[model samples]
Target: MSSIKNILYFQAGLGVLANMFLLLFYIFIILGHRTKPTDLISCQLTFVHIIMVLTGGDILFTDLFELLNIENDFRCKTIFYISRVMRGLSICTTCLLSVFQAVTISPSTSLLAKFKQKLKKYKVYVFLCIWSFNLSFSTNRIFYVGGFTNVSETNHMRVTKSCSLLPMNYIIRGLIFTISTSRDVFLVGVMLTTSAYMVITMFRYQRQCKYLYSISHLREPPEKRATQTILLLVSFFVIMYWLDFIISFTSDMLWMYDPVILTFQKFMMYAYPTITPLVQITSDNRIIIMLKNLKANHHQGLF
Candidate 1:
C-alpha cells in the first residue's frame, strides 16, 4: 500500500507538469493559426486535460488525507462532482476532434462535406451546448457521492478511507449508472466509426491514384497528417478510458478491501491527461521540429 501511494504521488506530480506543457503546446498552435477549426478543438482538448489533471490531483490529495484518517465530506463531494463532469467534457472534445478531422478531409461531393460547412458555422454553439449538458448530468454527483468510513473493516491496524456513493435504492443507482455509461458508449462509438472512416478514405484515395495515370501526377494523400494525428489521439484516449472503466467496474463489483485496487483506480484518473500531450506532439511534425530546436538551444546554453 505504501509503495502504491508513493507511486501515485509521483504520478500526480507528473500529471501537473504534463497539463502545463500541453497547455503551452496547444496555445502555441492556436497562435500560429488563429482561425482553424481543428486548432480550436485542440485548444479545447488541452484545456480539458488541464482541468482533468487538477481535479484528479484533488482526489489524490483527499485520498492521502483519508489514509491519515481524515475525511471531509464537502471536499469529497466537490472533487468527485467536478472530476466526472470534466471527464465527460474531455470525451466530448475528443469526439469532436475526430468528427471534425473526418469532415476536413472528406471529398467535396460527399455528405460529410455539407456537414463540414455547417460545422464551421455552428461549432461555437455546438460546443457550448455540450458543455451545458455535461454539467447538467454531473449534478447527480452532488446527491450520489460523499465521503464515508468503512465501519466493516476492523483492520484499523492500518487502513484508508475513501469516498463512496450515498446509498440509494437499487433502481435509482442502476438508472444513474446506465445513463452515464450510455453517454460514454455513444461517444466511444462516434470516435471509432469516424476514425475508421478516415482510414478508409485514405486507402480509397491511394487506390484512385493507382488507376489514373494522368491524375497520379497530382495525387495527394487521402488525409492530412494532422487528421491521422487527431484520430490516433482519440484512439489512445478511448483505450485508456475503456480500461479505466473496466477496472473501476470490476473493483466495485468485487467490493474488495485491497488498497492496490484503489490506488490503481486513482492512477487511471491521471493516466490519460498525463500521456495525451506526449502522444499528440509526437504525431505532429511542427511540434517535433520546435522540440528539436529547443533541445539544441538548451545544449548551447550549457556551454
Candidate 2:
C-alpha cells in the first residue's frame, strides 16, 4: 500500500509539472502568433490533463478538503463533475487531433483534403460544441455523487475517502451507462479509423519519398513527424482508457471497490495524462529547438 501510494504521488507530481510546462509552451506560441492548426487542440488537451490530474484526489491527497473546511457534498460533487467533464474532453480532443492530422497529411486530390480549410476555419466552433455537450452530459454527476456517509449502504460505491456514488434508479442507471458507453465507443471507433488511415497514408508517402530521394538523402518531414506523434498519443490513450473503463465498470456493477483494485484503476486512469506531455515535448521539434536556443543563450551569457 505504501509503495503504491508513493508511486501515485510521484506520477501525479510529474504529470502536473509536465502538463503545466506544455500548456505554457502552447500558450506562448499562440500569443506570439506562431500557432499551428494543431496548437489549439494540443493546448486544450494539455489543460484537460492538468485538471484531470488535480481532480484525481487519490493522486494529490484528498486530505486537503478537510484542511480547507470544504463542505463534503460540495467537494465531492465538484471534484467528480470536473473530473468527468475533463475526461470527456480528453477523449474528444484526442479524437479531433487525430482526425485533423489525418486530413492534414492527405493528398491534395483526396476527399479528406477538402475539409482541411473548413476544419481549421470552424475549429473554434467545434471546440465550443464539444465543451457544451460534455458539460451538459456530465451534469447528472452533480446529483449522483456526494460525501460517503454510509459504508453499510451497499448501493453507495466509495470512489474516494470522502466521495461515494449514490444509487440511482435501475432504469436510469442503465440508460446512463448505455449512453455513455455508446459515446465512448463511437469516439474510439473514430480514433481507430483515423489511425488506420494515417498508417496507410504514411506508408504510401514513405514509398514515394524513397523513389524521389536516395536513402542517404531521405529525411522525415515535420508534418510526418507530427502525425507519428499523434498516432502514438492516440494509441496510448485508447489502451489506458479501456483498461480504466473496464475496472470502473466492474466496480460499479458490483457496487464495491477493493482498495488495491481501485488504486490500480486510478493508476491506469492517470497513465495517459501523465505521459501525454512527455510524448509531446520529446516529439515536437519546435519545443526542442526552443530549448536548444535557450540553453545556448544561457551558456554564452555564463561564459
Candidate 3:
C-alpha cells in the first residue's frame, strides 16, 4: 500500500507539472487580452491547475520525507494542512467548472440563462465566493492534522508522520465531505441534464435544417458551436469521474492494496486538469486563430 501510494504521488507530480505548463501557456499565449466566455473559463481552470500543482508537489515531498524516515513535526503538519487545502480546492474548482459550463450553454428559456448577462460582469465575485467557500470548509483540518508520535499497530505504517483523525474531527470532516459530495452530485446532474437537452435541441435543429434543405435552403444557422463544446466537456467529465469514483469506492470496500487501482484513480483525478487546456484550444476557434497567428509571426521572423 505504501509503495502504491508513492507511485501515485509520482504520477500526480508529473500530471501537475504538465498542468502547470499548460496553465502558463493558456494565460500568456492563448488567452492574451481576450474577454470571451471560453477565455474566462480557461483562466478559471488555470487557477485550479496551479492549485493542483502545488498540492501534488506537497504530496510528493511528504512521500519523500516518509521514505527517508524524517520525523519533523512542523513539516508534517504543514504538509498535511497544505495538502488538505489544495485537494479541497481542486475538487471545488472542478465542480465550479461543471456548473459554469452548464450555465453557459443554457438556452434563453432556461432559468440559469438569466445569469449569462451577469456572468461576465460578476465573474470576479463568483470566483471569490468559490474560493471563500472552499477555504472556510477546509480550515478545520488545520487544527486536527498534527503529527502523531506513534502509529496504530493494526494498519500498516505507511508513513511515520502518522496523523490520526480525532473523534470530533470526523464530524467536521463528514460535514465537509457531505457538502462537497452534494456539490459534485449537483454539478454532474446539471451537466448530464444540460447535455441531454443540448442533444435533443440539436436533433430538432437538424430536422428543421433537413426540411429546409429539402426545399434547397441553407442549413440552420451553423448550429451553436458552444453547445457542442459543452457537450464534449460534459462527456469527458462523466466518463473520467465515474470511473474514478467507482474504482475508489471499490478499493475502499474491498480494502484492496492493488497498485493498479491507485494508478487509475490518480490518473483520472489529475489527467482532466492537465489536458483541459488542449481541449479548450482545440474546441475554440479564437484560441486556435491566435496560436496560428503567433506561429506565423514566429516563422516570418525566422525567415
Candidate 4:
C-alpha cells in the first residue's frame, strides 16, 4: 500500500512538471510575441500556473519525507498552507477563465457586449481582483495549519504546524466551501450557455451563406475561429473539472485513508493539468505556428 502511494505521488509530480514546462513555453514563446499588452486572463493564469507548480513540488517533497519517516514541522506546515492556496487558486483561475472566454465570445447584440471594450482597458484591474479575492481566502489556511503533535487523548497524527482552528471555525470553513462551489457552478453555466449560443449562431450563419448561392458572397465569419477556440476550452474545462469533483466528493465520504479514494484523488488533481497542455497542442494552431517559426529561426541563425 505504501509503495502504491509512492507511485501515485511520483505520477502527480510528473503532471505538475509537465504543466509547468508548458505554461512557461506559452508565456515566453507564445505570449511574448504579442504586440498588445498582456490581458487579465493571461497574467492571472500564468501566476496561478506557477503557484500550482511550486505547490506541487512542495507536496512531492513532503510525501518523500513522510515515506522516509522524517518529521520536519516547519516544512510540513509550509507545504500544507501552500498546497491549499495553490489548489484554491487553480479553481479560481479556471472559473475566471471560463467567464472571460464566455464574455469574449458573446454576440455583439447581447448585453455582455459592453464588457468587451472594458476588458481591453481594465485587464490589469481584473487580474488584481482575482489575486486579491484568492489571497483573502488563502490566509485562513495559514492560520489553521499546524505541526504534527501527538496527544494522550488520541493516537499520534501528523498535524500541520501553525495556529490551529477551534471547533467554532467550522462556520468559516462552511462559508468558504459554499462560496467556492457557487462560483464554480456559475462559471460552468456561463461557459455552457455561451458555447451553445455560438454553435447555434454558426449554424445559422452557414445556412444563410448557403442560401446566398454566390461564391464571392460567402466568407467565414470574423468570430468563427474565436468561437471554436472558446468552445474547445470550455469542453476541456468541464470534463476535467467534473472528474476532479467526483474524486474529491468520494474521498470526503470514504476518508483519505481509503486506498482507492486516495489513488483517485491524486490522479484527478495531478492528471487534470496534463490534459490542458495536450488540448492546446492539438487544437491551437497559433501555438504550432509559433513553434515552427522559432525552429526555422534557430536553423537560420545556425547557418
lDDT per residue for candidate 3 within 74-93, as digits (tens), equals 56666656655565555555
Residue range with the least summed lDDT across 10 consecutive positions in model 1: 151-160
Clash tally, candidates in order: 0, 0, 0, 7
In model 1, what lDDT does residue 227 have?
74
lDDT of 4 by residue, 1-303 (tens): 668657666766556565565566656654566522223354455456555644553356565666887655655666666666666666666655655665666667888778878876776686667667766766765554555444333332222222122232447756866776787777678667767866876787677678777757766553566457556766876887787667655543333334465455555555545555555455555667877999999999999
Ranked candidates, highest TM-score first = 2, 1, 4, 3
Clashing pairs in 4: 146-160, 146-161, 146-162, 147-159, 147-160, 147-161, 148-159
Best-first order by lDDT: 2, 1, 3, 4
Query: What C-alpha lDDT does candidate 4 achieve relative to the native structure?
Result: 0.59
Tell me the tens digit of each residue's lDDT in model 1 across 1-303.
567667767776676676677678778766777445687787788788777876774546575655776547776777777788889999999999899999998899888988987998899998899899999999986886666666355322111254666556668867887998899999999999999989888888777777877663864442467776777787788888888788766755554436665566677778888777777667666678888999999999999
Worst 10 residues of 2 by lDDT: 57-66
**What is the clash count of model 1?**
0
Instruction: Name the regions of candidate 4 deviating beyond 4 angstroms.
Output: 1-21, 29-40, 61-71, 147-173, 212-226, 250-256, 294-303
Best by lDDT: 2
Query: Candidate 1: what lDDT?
Result: 0.75
User: Model 1: which residue pairs collide?
Assistant: none
Candidate 2 regions exceeding 4 Å error are 57-61
Which candidate has the highest TM-score of all?
A: 2
